[model samples]
Target chain A: MSTWSMALRQSDYYWTLYRRTWKGSVFSSFLTPLLYVLAMGVLLGGFVEADPSRLEGAPSYLAFVAPGLLAAQTMQTAVFETTYPVLSATKWQRVYFGMNATPLRALDIANAALGFVLLRLVLIAIVFVAVLAPFGVFVSVPAAIGALLVSILVGAAIGMPVYAYAVGVPNESSFSLIFRLGVIPQFLFSGAFFPISNLSPALEWLARLTPLYQGVDLTRMLSLGTWHTGPALVHLAYLLVLLVVFHRVAVRRLAKRLAF
Target chain B: MISARGLRKSFQQKGQEPFEAVRGIDVEVRRGEAFGFLGPNGAGKSSTMRMIAAVSPVSGGSLRILGLDPATDGSQIRGRIGVCPQEDSLDTELTVAENLYVYGRYFGIGRAEVRRRAAAQLEFVQLTERGGAKVEDLSGGMKRRLTIARSMINDPEMVLLDEPTTGLDPQARHVLWDRLFRLKQQGVTLVITTHYMDEAEQLCDRLVVMDKGLIVAEGSPASLIAEYSTREVAEVRFGIGENESSAGAVESAVGRRAERVEVLPDRLLIYAADGEAAVAAVHDAGLQPVATLVRRSSLEDVFLRLTGRTLVD
Candidate 1:
């Protein structure tokens, strides 16, 4: 079968599974980040009001964190969705055995899984953007849509490698380590919650190398309409490179793992 | 057609010896025939099945399915082969009909065609009434039938079933057998493995009895029984004490009447051409047993004779 057909089929399969079995988790997954934005930006920032810097132009703190939160939430959801679920379908539940028994190849299954993650990222981003509109965070409708697409691409770029790692390893400990050493570090040091310029030079260099930093930087640029061509190109290049490299790895690993 | 020559597979264990699961065996399955691999657990039946299914790589051998090398044309070969794995791997999140519909899509079937096939397959498995029910709510038998129906979504040329009736009740097993029989009648080649001697006797046109990664015997059920065991068997039991040492006496007493004598912990089995005459002779010899039964030889006898152990062991 053609790759597109297989990918579309697998995406539908995952969507059906998620809608029926994971409906309860979807609301909480999309709601938690919105609450975080409101509590951290409006509630917390109101009590600690300080003179607004020039970089922090017209929008309030809530608007500033809104796009970054959307990107971060998408990354979080996409990474977990692709990694554990992919591993479980292969090793734990062994659902791919049935799928691969048909015309679907391993690469088809991988693409389908990635497609599903992308779709979920977009859905979550739309919810985040809709919630932010009431808080006066959404600047331009077109820019908000562009930011949402960028969030999905960035999340997928980061998640595909983790998906590859999850399928290759035989146990769950490696995923735990990735969450502890990889994801936690990215979440804390990637300038999602605070400005990176205030950090030490060594920390900034480390943060700049992370996928989350590039993603948040791009989101911040889109949200503030402060799109400098050079930084935008650099962030786009980083995400593109990651997407190509990790997608190749995921396809190869899945082929070796699922196909004989 | 499926063919394999010098097929071998070995698994390396950490800090211990490497276990050879399949050891240089040859096999061929022709079109429109019911072939079976009959063996006890850990006899490499599953390893062989996996190799044939093209989901597990061959360590040192040549294998082909439908005139294609699994290593190169795995997807193409799999496209025409249905596989019912030992475990029921149905998507528990989906409804009965949705499970079939989505699995058909995996074969690149169109949505309209998948819907039509799903309906027909669900009806074939007698699950049409409960098509909308979630998978987790189905009984084990229903789940197994659904898995079988899911495998046929592509209308494959061959169907591979690994221990299809391993954990089903008698009625459920019979229902599955009936469905498989109908498929065989429609000229679909079937490959199956099971430890149940009765299942093999009922379904297999030809079978290989495997033990410890090797084939010990290969033939039809009737032929294997005729070759390995007598036509009839007699079981004689005495209510001796737990610590009794009368096994030797019983063996000596029935030795002349039967072709062979098997002494168990609680009884003695006498293999003979005519079980009724043998039991009468035992009575004539004044060996008053607590219980006695005469029956025809079964595939279980063939298995025991070849492997030197019970099939369930």
Candidate 2:
């Protein structure tokens, strides 16, 4: 088999597995984001005034937070998918070993897993957009589509590194530490809830450096029609670099764990 | 077919010396024959099997499977061979049939072909009735059977089984052995690794006895037994500490007939051509044991004679 064919064949294992258990994740992947929009945007927005300048060109608090949450949702999906499921395949269920025993190489397994995560992120982004369309969160159909694509890119950028880290983790005890130290902080401070400028100078610089923040900013700009070419390219380049570098690391580490 | 010369595998641990799992062993497996690696746990059987399976890189020396170098052509070799690892790495999320289907797909088989082969394999393993059941719902034996069936889904020319029937009841083991026997009869090359001497004798046409990362002896079971052990073994059990003290007396009692006497924790095994005569002589020497039994020598005796340790522990 060709490399792409082998990868698709291996990913078909994940696709078959996901078909049986995808319903169980609907609450977390879909409902949790919608609830965040409801609680943080609509109910909480009523108490705050609509300040477009401070909200980074958004018309209301709901408009400001919803698009950023879309980006954050992508990050969350990517993070959640990469951590436990990656570990389960490598260590618990040993499905990666099973795949490695076949014609599929270790790189094929890694690519297929990351590809599945990307697919899930895209699906979740599309559904999140469709679910929030009536709320007028998206300013234009083309911009919304652009935001969706950027969300997936941002997810893969974050997910790939986590995939690299997860393959070598000894057990599940370390996953909570990733969420507590890495994911939760990124979600809270990465321009999702508010602009990073609200923080102190040092923390602002730190937030600006995070891929999640870049993703949030890019996703917000695209959704609200405030995108700037130079800054957009910078954000896109940052995410692309992280994605490429970590994809190499993840594939190598996966080979070490499964093929050795 | 598989061939190796000075094959070695070692694992490097942090802040520690590297542990050598396979210490320069040579092996050759012919096509359409059942070959076995018999050893206790940590004897490097699985490591060697992994090398043959092409999932693990050779730490040193030369190795080849299906006439292709594993380092470069692992995917090609894996495509033509099947592996049932020691652990049942079956997909718990998919149904029994779906597990087979997914594994077959990993070989790049088309969906219709995979479905057809999956049905045939499930039927072969006598799991046709439970095709739609969740894998977790199956018993251990059934799970192993499913794993074996999954291995055969691609119609591989060679199948590698690592401890194929460990942790199974007698009836379950017999059923698995019967299935493997059928596979052997079908002219598929079989490579099996097992600690069970009976399993080795029952299924393997030729086997190597491995211990402490080296192959100590290799031959057909009967030939190895004839070369390394006597025809019969007289087992005499005494109360705990009494067995060790009685070894000398038992050996002397059997005289020239006893080739060797192995004193285990709870019993004394006297290797002799005539076990009944050996047992009678033990009684004649006024050494009475709690239990006395005479049985034909087996591969277990050959292992005990070679390693000074039992095969299972």
Candidate 3:
């Protein structure tokens, strides 16, 4: 078998396992994220989101904020997929050690794990987009698909670096920091609830530097059917570089930890 | 199928002196032969096993598994060998059969083929009826047996079992031994390590006795016992605190009757070809305060004779 095939075989273990365990979290993935979108975008948007100064020329506040929530939810799903489960695979349950005992190299196992994480990202992003579709969140179907794809890239760009860090310092205490300090702040400040225009110049610059803000920028353009090719390309390039560099880091760290 | 020359492994912890787990030990495991490492804890038996399995890098010396250099061809060598680590590292998330099938896929086995081997291995380990059971539901012995079955999923040519029966009951140990013996009969090489001399004697065709990062002795179980220990031993135990306090008197009384004598905390062992005569000589010397039993020598005796200590601390 080819190396990719070998990696896929390694990932097959997770797929089979997830099939048996996914039921417990099915509602959280769809209903919970959807509820957050409806409550924050529809119910809360009617009173304050109608102000034109902050809506960024979008038709409605729900349209303006729906794409940002999609990006934030993607980031949450990505970090969730990479940290605790990956640590268990290496340090606790020792599934990665079990796999390394076979013909698979540490690189193959890392790649397989990354592949499984991305698959989960795709499934979750699709559900998030589906929840927003009934409320006229999309100007065009293809553009909505483009936003979903870009949001996945955004999740991965952030997820890979977090995964790299998690594999090395494998303790439960660090996870609270990721969620409280890292994820929740980005979800709130990085144009998810309001445009960067609403933030002061310093905070907007800081938000632009992070992955979720770039994701929101590119996805907002796609959702409104207003393609700003120049800025969109920058967002795309920023995300691609983040994914590549962080993926390399994650692989190196995991290999160092797993192999002698 | 496995050879090593002056193999060594040393770990360097920050702010501490480097600890040498295996200090330049040499070993050779022939095809279909049961080779054993009998040693106490911290004697580097598991470190040596990791080096042979290609999971750990060698700090010094040359090593080859199936004629492949682990430095360059670790994955290639790992593909053909199986390791049952000292800890039961079975995946508890999957069912017993699912664990077998999933582990087989790590060897790049096809789905249908892995399924077939998983079923066969379950039967081989006598867990066929519990295939659908979750791994956590099985008893400790069953979990151990399932681990053994997982190791065989790749149908490896050589299998390394580190302390395969350390915490197991006698019946569980015997059952696992039966499965291992069947593997040997099918022409599969087995490498095992344990402190249990009886286990070494029963499982090893040839073995090495290691202590404090060195191989103190190496031979077939019978030859090592014959070379290092007497044919029989007279074990005498005194009442209460008398065993330790009466060491000098017992040594002088029965010392010359036997070839060698060892004083332990609880008992005094007099080694000789004729143990009954040694006991009678002890009685004639007016040292008749306790109980005595004479038994044939075992690897435990050889270990005690060579190392000047009992096998079980």
Classify candidate 3 by CAPRI docking class: medium
Per-residue lDDT over B189-233 for candidate 1, one digit per residue giving the tens place of the 0 to 100 score: 999999999999999999999989988998999999999999999
lDDT of 3 at B270: 83
Q: Return the candidate ranking by lDDT, descending.
A: 2, 3, 1
lDDT by residue for model 2 (B133-169), tens? 9998999999999999999988999999999999888
Q: Tens digits of per-residue lDDT for model 3 on A43-161?
A: 88877736554577688888888889888888988898889988888778788778877888777888888888898899888988988888898998997899899889888888988
Chain B, per-candidate TM-score = 0.96, 0.99, 0.97
Which of 2 and 3 is the better model by lDDT?
2
Query: Tens digits of per-residue lDDT for model 3 on B1-313?
Result: 8989999999888899999999999898999999999988888999998888888889999999999999889899998999898877777878999999888888878889999999999989999999999887888889888888888888899999999998999999999999999999999999999999999999999999999889999999999988998889999888877787766776677666678778787888888888898888778888875799999999999888778877788
Error of 3 at A67 (Å): 1.3
What CAPRI-style quality would you assign to candidate 1? medium
Off by over 4 Å in 3: none
Residue A64 displacement (Å), model 2: 1.1
Which segments of model 2 are wrong by more than 4 Å?
A: A26-30
The candidates, ranked best first by DockQ, are 2, 3, 1
Better of 1 and 3 by DockQ: 3
